[model samples]
Target: MTLGNWFALLVALVVAAEVVRALRHRAVRQERWRRFFRLRTTSWGLGILTFLLAVALAAPLLAPFDPNRQLDIVHLTNRPPSSTFLLGTDPLSRDVWSRLVYGTRVSLGIGALGALVAVALGDGLPFAALVVAIGLTSWFGTSRLVRAEVLSLRQRDFVVAARALGAGSSRVIVRHVLPNAAAPIIVSAALGVGNVLLLEAALSFLGIGVPPPDASWGNMIADGMPSIYTAPWSTFFPGLAISLVVMSLNGVADGVRDALDPREAP
Candidate 1:
């Protein structure tokens, strides 16, 4: 009935949509995925990403306590999780879980958006000029290194064959070179998402995070630090959330790496 409740409900709906979409992909693209089905790593990557994402999204609806509520300011200060509050209250008496859920939304949104921005900054846009742009942006300060590497790769038989087949330089770069180079970039982007979450929490801890009544894990940590000697749960749960989210991203990236690179498999 409160804003936290509504926020949580919105999370639940998004999660349901994600689940449905994943299932639909499985059904419709079953054969397509199966061709690479030996790629258990891909499935694992997607599954773990889906799981962590669902957990973060559903935080509001599933969390028992009203995350933003200020409980008994006196007795609740520094108290650990109990029947009364599954995750202890902060210095301000707000529920740690609620703030955590809201924080999840902020962290995930920023990571996703930031990665997209990075990707879009590449020059492969509406025209061939964009390809030049992408090249410039991607190589930026590393131009000398990239040029040397590309020169070496250009001598490979595949590159020679592609050139003979009438593939233009841009085509070769897009089809051949980029694919080879993308492995590390994709891995780095996915793995870095957890770092965004930590940053969000830190911001909240400083009281500069999400505005009041919205709740945030960082805010919870900020509130709990003084009471850490009393109610460890205040900081513990949010810290745990940050750890788990980061670990999940690591797992997802590992799975993706294995799936994409067959040579890595035994």
Candidate 2:
């Protein structure tokens, strides 16, 4: 019923999922999927992400209190946490912890959801368009490089042998060309998450992101500006949460990239 209990349960579920995945990785015979599981770093990064998401999902129900509600002025205005207010009370006497918790859901939710929506929409026409542009620009930038590499690989004895063995051009391209050419693309895409979150935060901070009735960290800071000196926690807590989530995402993404790319080297 309480926030702590819900958070604990969520953690337990994630741990259980991880254990099951670990067991499956050990027990399953699928070599392809097994390779994925063997990448411990990816799993670790994903676990961090999943926990962040769980906190967001439970925000509405388990926030310390209604973020928008004005608290009783008699108790504590701009009060640091006491027996009554866990994290602290803001200028308006609203609970800083509760707003921060719920705002996590809003800010992260909008950032992530907006990014996914943009990506999803782009995956169709815009993506195809970008693919074309990417194909063109990439060819412009690295066509020479890709060609040199491909030509060198082609001259390799194994490639010659495969060609002599009747492997089609398609097979050669699929097996060789793509594996080498796709890495940059994946890396580029991975870099987009931070930019997307920043954009979302900017939008929210500008007051256009999520309308009121929603608790966004950016918007919270925006709302707190006028009273910030009087009650800095109102600004600090939400801003800190936003910064942490965005930084966490960046860290996780970098970890995954390093984990997956052995060529990055020890």
Poorly placed runs, candidate 2 (over 4 Å)? 1-48, 73-76, 114-173, 262-266
Off by over 4 Å in 1: 1-49, 114-155, 206-213, 262-266
Candidate 2: residue 117 Cα off by (Å)? 9.2
Residue clash pairs of candidate 2? none
lDDT of 1 by residue, 14-79 (tens): 665576457546746554333333444444445545655675657656566666677777777655
Provide TM-scores for the models: 0.65, 0.61
Report the lDDT tens digits of candidate 2 across residue range 133-190. Answer: 3334333434555566677677778678879999999998897666654554344444
Cα lDDT for residue 80, model 1?
60
lDDT of 1: 0.60
Least accurate 10 contiguous residues by lDDT in model 2: 126-135
